[model samples]
Target: MLDLTKLAQQMQGMSQQLTLEATATRQRLELAEKLLSHAFSRQNKLTTHQQTWHDRLSFTAAEPVEPLNLRIAIPVPPAAHTVIATDGSQIAPSHHEIAYCYLINVGRIILHYGQNRLPLLDSLPEVFYRPEDLYISRQWGIRTEEWMGFRRTVSEAVVLGELGERIKDEGGGMRDEKRQNRETRNQRVEAVASFHPSSPIPHPPPHPSSPIPHPSLAMVDGSLIHWFLEPLPGEARDRILPPVLAAWDQLRTNRIPLVGYVSASRSGEMVNFLRLQACPYDTPDCMTHCSNQGDRSPCQVLDPLKDAALWATQLEPGQRSPLWRSSARILDLYGDHRIYFCYVHVGTEVARIEFPAWVAEDADLLDAALSLTLAQVQKGYGYPVALAEAHNQAVVRGGDRARFFALLEQQMIRAGLRNVGTSYKEARKRGSIA
Candidate 1:
């Protein structure tokens, strides 16, 4: 006998756990939908103005457009300035890759993403009143009356696929098995249609063994191109590059320096755990003792900041020790280079500031960049500035407060400082005593 009673109990427990998880997931998804809906609603109000500007820009199709060919040229107005960022990611089920090209200029932002075969203009809103249709089309590739029939099909397919995957992991359900079988059959039919030469559908070229040859385009003056490429075969490079460059030119009018930030570590718990894993040896040594390595020691190779701090205490001034040399060394070794600047303060959340590189050296430019970046961060991540000290520090001997203050003031003036007093007040109000 196959212990039917015990099996039934186990099955019931598993079902209950799954149901609870599904309920929680549903709640999270509902919340995400609400947020997205709110954002879309707000954006719809601005769409008319945006569309007017877009209409003013000329976008002529390339002559005798072949199937899967989409070429759009938008003129760069004189004195026009903008920053554009482009990124690509693969979608599941179909395994088709989509590229998102974002154009931001003077507080105006536009986002476009889809396959080349499905040009963005084809799906752009025809009626200003039906703006929500744009979001629906982008997400599910269906709109208006077509959506009523296709929406259920797409949603059911997604749900079934998810359910099939879960059943495969758990090793259960005849219904899931049947669904997977059906899906597999449908995929085979679609694959055949996709590969057929007679079919109108344009499919991505088969993965080539060699690297794709990237075509070089003449860079337009007063424009910057930031290209994020999908890993393509060598043979396909020539075909991909031109479209990428064309898209880049269409989006922006100025060369913006790309800058990113780096961080030593995130959560303190994670840092501590990583530190223990990185410990060189079990036995206590003089250097390790100085490092305050207790029961758990961090990985020295991974945590260069910890290493630098340790070595800083051990090494004397003007010492030839490589470990205590420069802050850049610590940053170079273990920093995450996605943001422009990492603000490090003991017992405070890490501040990752991302900005264009051109503004870095110029104080006035940096201030403007920081203001915009900080505002975005505050609105998104909810962080307030703690202090408005001069970026360049002056070390005064014998703790001369007056000299320090004078040097700080001079640097602030040189930097074309503003908003320092306000920032200080906000910090104080938030109980940041320091």
Candidate 2:
């Protein structure tokens, strides 16, 4: 029923629009493909770059430079040892919920490796929910959710530190009848805290000898350096740093070495060090390599490559990269516990391990920690077993979260507190007839 001329005009307009879009899209696709292809050319160059710079690459650190291609075999693990691993989990504030609060849970496990893979004492899911616990004040100067993640880590350290204190209190003795009578080589005293719903913190039980905790390596789940890096100046810094440092002090007082295990790290410290070698001569060469207009060298090409990727091919199973002091800024705060790192290959991927400067300074401590870590990795196939246990205990599931809120609601109603209801969206998700 439409006029033929009008219909023809409308079709012509549609065709023009489609043609313009196609032309623009085609150009964009061609440009993007060209750019992507050009980027790969650099990685190819690094793969073929001269091997001389690789020898003298480390300069920023005071320690001797380890060759980029160097790999050392892992030492044999001791016959019997203990690993105390601590891990943390958190639930950030949710709009679908009642209160403007977040919760953090820390899990710790102490395992002994001499007799029968015995696990001694473990603290599971210690929850925190205080006004001071919930949010970081504007004064902390940290943008990371009022330092929530940082606080969670600090809490984990605090718990471990408390354990160290208790060990000292008990004099590391097995004189207690419960520990003496236990059939298994490893004995456990389990106690967890819940401040809410009015639960009291339990006292430390008698020491279990299965895994003598003291003189053992205290392992934390993530990077020790990363947590200490949260920028808090003046009083804010003072407020947060003490708890972690105290934990370190306590563990060291008990003769326990601290080890931090990071799986699948995206750090570029190795790659950055390697870049120093790839530079033509000095700092200028390094700076020029990053410049857009400079002669694009292999140094520039290797920019996107991660240390994990570079070290993966260079390291063999059970072999480790040479130790290097971390150049991270936060390390300046750790007076005696300055951090050092090395990579260990577990037949699958290279995992980064970090330890204190004191641990590295002593030859025996370093070897003992590394050996124990490798033993755990071997048993676990790749991951450390103690860390695995800590993570398993710390993880807060969705169903568990729901039950927690339900319990909170029940207590709120009993106390005649104002009802805090969930959003309609959540209500619909919970029960929808349609």
For model 1, the local distance difference test gives: 0.27
Question: Which prediction has the highest TM-score against the true structure?
Answer: 2
lDDT of all predictions:
0.27, 0.64
lDDT of 1 by residue, 1-434 (tens): 49998799899889999898766655544443343234334433223322333222111111111111111121212121211121111111111111111111111111111211111110110111134532444443333333322232222222222222221221222224345664464554354334322343322322222111111011111111112122323333333344433332221112222222222322121122223223344431324343464333433323222322322232332221110011121122212221122222211233333332233344433443334333322433442211111001111233443343345456666788753222344336546535
Clash numbers, per candidate: 17, 0
Put down candidate 2 lDDT per residue, 260-339, tens digits, no spaces: 98899877665554453345554423333444555455444454445565566557888888776776656678788888
- Each prediction's TM-score versus the true structure: 0.22, 0.71
Residues forming the 10-long window of minimal summed lDDT in candidate 1: 118-127
Off-target runs (Cα >4 Å) in candidate 1 are: 1-341, 344-351, 354-364, 381-434
lDDT of 1 at 51: 33
Q: Give the TM-score of candidate 2.
A: 0.71
